[model samples]
Target chain A: MSDLPKILHVEDDPDIREIALMALEVVGGLDVVQCASGAEALERAPGIAPDLLLLDVMMPGMSGDETLTALRKVPQFSETPAIFMTAKAQHSEVDRLKELGALDVITKPFDPMTLADQIISIWQER
Target chain B: MSQGSESYLVSLLGPATAGAVVSLAILLMIGLLARSALGHRRQLRKIREQEDDLALQRKAVDMHAMVKITGVDGRILYANDNLIQTIGYSVEELRGRYASDVFLDEDPRIAAEMWETLRRGDAWTGDNKLRRRHGTAIWVKTTAIPKMGRNGTLDKVITVYTDITDAKLRQQEGPLRAMFDRLQDEVYIFSVDDLRLHYLNKRARASLGWERLNYRSHFLSETTSTFDEARFRERVAPLLAGEVEAVIYESSLSGRPVEINLQLDESVVGEPRFVAVVRDISQRKQVEQARAAFVATVTHELRAPMTSIKGAMKLVASGATGPIPDKPAQMIDLALRNVDRLLLLINDLLDLEKLDNAQTEIRRDPVNLAELIDDAIAHNMGYAQEYGVTFTALPAMPSTLQIVGDRDRLMQVLTNLMSNAAKFSEVGGVVEVGLEDRGDEARITVTDHGIGIPEEAQSRLFERFVQAETAEHKKRKGTGLGLSIVKSIVERHGGRVDFFSIPGEGTTFVIDLPKASDEMSRAA
Candidate 1:
């Protein structure tokens, strides 16, 4: 893995995905590969060899947890750090996502400028 | 002249012939007298025997039944022993009293009807509630027949009463019948053995469109359209077998949603019976659907735009694109602040909705109160700084106080109180958070040195969307649901939340939570 983190962002909403990409790439100066759905992320994840996974909890097909489970099956991505992005900010939901192997859970409508910092903190912790 | 001539001839013929004629005449007279006396004696004996038979029949009726004889004007001429004993009255007390005043209902119409039937010489057979001497009433099944005089006018009424008080009382006292009759929900009772309907309240009859005359004869299967035979049997089998206390299911009856609660009444007299209460829930269901749809639309349509606006504002405020001028920067700052307020309002609205609907489930776990307070202070430190207020953790707080509750919800309560304190505080005011150990409970108090709640608004402080109408509150925009949400969350965790305040001085909020035991901590 390179010094600069390579993140794979999977979100169903095009607007959120585009803004997040700009935040991670332009504002934070990091490499990001964005996918519209979990299925798309799974297909491109092996080729991208991203250092981390940023998955949305509520998605059309293959939820964040389901995608994480599928990715963990692959030997190369077994121990990759993953974080969940969701609108469900309840403490119970956050704890449940953590139990499912997410490094952290970030709530929606997050500060765009600070989003990259939040992700970087999680990456560094990993 | 012929007799004189016959006497002269007889004297001439012989004295013996005259003596024989006299003897024959006397013998004939004695035989006739004897026959008349024998006939008169036989007639007297027959009359006495008939009177004895009538007396015996009257004695038998008086002994076995409650008999009473009333005159034409309803005067109680006589009352049998059974009648006097059952009514708890002496014969002297009942005699000569008007039967209507003694035994009939207090209603004038019923007494009038009884008299009319008797005057018409027709028998009156019905149930009557008669008041006793001691003021208690007894029900009797009565039959009164009018006796006609020689002139064919009604002379007297002979009434026979059989006590039916026990059956009447049982019917009244069984399973709260009076209360069931007054209920709005339809109630029905069915025999467990045959699944036949045994009783239905007035509401049930009216709701099911049943006629009073035929309702009692109808079976449960014919009355309710919601449950077929197989489904009803399946649902009722558990109750009949004492496997479950009650069976509740939602189904439609008469094209409307209804909730049916059925339970077995094993305490009923002969056999176990099933009692079911059916409530129409269409209106409640409609309201729930409308609320759910509104929440979904608000979450989706509103949050999507909010996400974009907040994101764009954050980028502008961060100076990511380019450096902003002074005036523009100030406007951006103000706009961002309002945006944050709007976000808080949205979050508070959702939380209040969830709490009101009881959809928010409290997850109880062992939580360290001291750590939770520290985290709350850290999280709200920015707001305190913005408002030029300081938060001080009083030394009274215990080092390792623990309780069983949902940590997130408790933290939310602390955060709400802290934020409110910061908003209302003077520039140099201090907000203090303290904890006290009280044996089995942990008391958390938040004290803020700021303008306190007005006395008039204090009572309604925890009501949704109610804010004290004051200048400071007007300037500070809020959803007015924070306190209500805090109260709900605290109460759901089996805790109490209360506050004390003095106008223009300060306010202090206290929350008491049960302390966690070692077993509870381990289980959590």
Candidate 2:
């Protein structure tokens, strides 16, 4: 909410998580705190206050929307903006995630180099 | 009474015998008068008894239910008291009003057909829907008898009706049970209180092995091969509680797959029942599971790996890993392009599968065809430019064309057609998308001045997995499912698609759709 610094990211798959970290940290040089599941995200939310929330939808236990819902209950992250990364690539799915109040939806198999620019562009447009 | 005739008779007769002859004549006249009086009395008595008999018959008929007399023209001439009380109309209000207008439906054909039967000297008996005072419709069992006049012409028709609305609402009755017994699918009638079987159709009897078991004593929980009493009760609890009319589920019966629909027969009082209809669904389940598995594999299994593979390939191809040699880089480009093609194939498979099994609902919203055509041409212009072809939308159509269809699906249809045309068109040639205002139907045309379809393959072009064997076969890239998807979407909208082609000359693909207003009118 304040600046383009810290991001709280949650995804179930380790490979996608590694790629996302490479895309965001190594390439874009943005600070981020990552978690494996929604429960872990909840556990880390009170300690690390991130500017934005990046999440992967269609997880095993809780979906990205549910993670956002759980995090919004925290006082520090109540109004934090969220973006979702999804492998189920359908335009309707994007619309649905947007309806759940995501700032933007990035479809799967995305180009890693431009992933940072897409998020930054979205932030600027908003 | 003639005086002259009497005097002539007296003169003719001898004066001495005149007194005796006159006395005999007076006695004969008195006897004739008494006999005439007796005859009159007997005839009057007979007439009075016949009138009494008719009055009794009329009273008995009136007490039965509503009764009305109509003229040959079907105008109410008289109505009984029961009729007046039941339909909320007085004798004066009903008299001379066409029976069709007062009691029958608004359709004149029903009245005409009923009268046609009556005039042919046959009684009309059927269930009739009668409108009450506040426009509520009630069902009635009606019997109309035709009365004839002395001149042998149809004089009037007397109709008798009894209220059958309650019975009609309780649709499960003796007559319907008889029909249920003859059904091809298995049927079971069971008591709701005890869950004991009451009746079973022949199919149910044959398949249930009725050699030694007493069907009447059998319980639902004990009948099916994989009977789960707790699960079945949980499923049917809503119906028993009146929350729903029926509950349906698929389970194995006699170790075979079946779909059972159970409905509570609460309409009958004192003895509540359940009607369960079972259908064998082994074949359907097989087909459904196969389709579902394929889609699941494509979406869940292949998609995750494809994401990693394609992304890694793209990062490598773009030299994000490091600066690679020219030869290997070109091959990486080829691999990336083919990966993209595989992704496209996955998407096409998804779309076609959804359309095939009716996973997507084709909406009937009114859409402007002309605007959609223009949008499709604009959207595909970049793709067309890749083929050295220019996509063009014709000038304003003569009239605005509107149709009932799913706008996105229709766009998919139009875009597919335009791209197909653009792909095969000659280099630097123009491909046009146009709309035509057919009166009852809206027409969309996609025309290309490229190598047209061959006469032989043209007939099967729209079939799935079928493609034209063009000279540049390797050049045209597709999943061979685009035209079939187009056909599927168009058909779902109650429309048709066809093409006119001359090989090496040109091809024009046309899609005809029912206009929105026309579809609405047809539904009405």
DockQ leader: 1
Off by over 4 Å in 1: A61-63, A66-79, B1-172, B181-297, B398-401, B438-441, B514-524
Over the full model, what C-alpha lDDT does candidate 2 score relative to the true structure? 0.80
* Candidate 1 C-alpha error for residue B191, in Å: 20
The whole-model lDDT of each prediction reads: 0.83, 0.80
Worst 10 residues of 1 chain B by lDDT: B265-274
Query: What is the Cα-based lDDT of residue A9 in candidate 2?
Result: 87
Name the runs in model 2 displaced over 4 angstroms: A1-6, A25-32, A89-92, B1-43, B54-181, B184-297, B363-366, B398-400, B517-524
DockQ of 2: 0.35
Query: Candidate 2: fnat, from 0 to 1?
Result: 0.43
Estimate the TM-score of every prediction. 0.58, 0.61
- Cα deviation of A80 in candidate 1 (Å)? 3.5
Kindly list the per-residue Cα lDDT of model 2 for residues A8-118, writing each as its tens digit.
889887777777777787677788789999999999888988878998887889888999988888888888889998866555677788987888998776777888888
